[model samples]
Target: MTHLKVGDKAPDFSALDEQGNRVSLSDYKGKKLVVFFYPKASTPGCTAEACNLNDNYQRFQSLGYEIIGVSADSAKRQANFKTKYGFQYPLLADEDKAVIEAFGVWGPKKFMGKEYDGIHRTTFIIDENAVITDVISKVKTKAHSEQILGD
Candidate 1:
């Protein structure tokens, strides 16, 4: 969904989290970041993906990486999803697609033979310097952490 690749400078973005608190790329300055873009909150695939990350949250943290999930869901929806799943990371409510567009994950997708515009399930692993080190375009929802950590 995105043309971005490893070694590309990650684009900066600012958006609201589930609590309406502002979140920006700058907040993660000096830390590695894992920014995963999903289509929605609370859906089966999305839940599996998020839970996978949550289950392995500490591993990423131990490796000096902070994870953030982004979707076009409303703040209320994001909050509910986080609360329901006990996610260890904040879910960004990018209702306006600012962060989504900035990352180039908002585009057409096909599922069950139906085509529609939505956020692509892509994950970008950015270094502390804000340069992308890996771009996971074909995300494996249930085993995403292993995919990211390569373990």
Candidate 2:
């Protein structure tokens, strides 16, 4: 599947959030969304990115945006990550990779000369109408939320 681009309808998906609640993209309709995909739950870079989002969460809320993080981790792990990092947003469990595949963030990646398939750190900003407004495929962990907010 091709990666989603700006102006395209953001693919709708439903997944179990950290709290075991069923959350769907359509549920957030009429509201802007920042949907981010990360590689793992508790890794350094992922944690940093999530924390940055947590820190700027109020700013995002003030801008009328809801933020969600997606990863291949289980709901339990996601809950732990959120609790450990004090993240105020929902972290969706994409153990089946359905949501990740739909967003085209699940793919092969190389690290330290090793090739593996995983979630590529990426973020998508969707407008209230569900049209994608911006995509950040190459994310810098520490500045992720800032970049998204800027866009």
Candidate 3:
């Protein structure tokens, strides 16, 4: 559900992470970045995806990639989720959705035959120069690390 595609320049964003620390796209200059947007914190699918990335944190680190998760959850909720799961990366508490909308990941979604507006689960792999190298719209939560690292 993202309008962004491979080779598109990643939209710039400056938002607060779980700890209320300011995070911005500029912070990751000269580094490969994985920005994964999830529907909610602590949900089944989101948990699996976040944990999968956490489990492979070292791999990403060794390969010079930094991971960040984004959701519309409150800072408290994001902090709780991170602490509970021991995630090694930052989880953006984008309650304002500035980053979400900038990336175009929020839109109509369906579940259990019900339709509503929500954040679409998506991952964008960006190279050091800020160009998107890949956009994983159909995320495989259980194998997300492989999806990003499967060169």
Candidate number with greatest lDDT: 3
Model 3 lDDT per residue over 62-145, tens place: 999999999999999999999999999999999999999999999998999999999999999999999999999999999999
Show the colliding residue pairs in model 1.
none
**Tens-digit lDDT track of model 2 for 1-151:** 2368999999989999998899998899899999999999999999999998999999999999999999999999999999988998999998999999999987788999999988888899999999999999888899987698774
Tell me how candidate 1 scores on lDDT: 0.95
- Please count the clashing residue pairs in each candidate, in the order shown: 0, 0, 0
Runs in model 2 deviating more than 4 A are none
Query: Which candidate should be chosen as best, given TM-score against the real structure?
Result: 3
Q: Give the poorly placed runs of model 3, Cα more than 4 Å off.
A: none
Candidate number that wins on lDDT, 1 or 3: 3
Cand. 3 Cα-lDDT = 0.97
lDDT of 3 at 117: 97
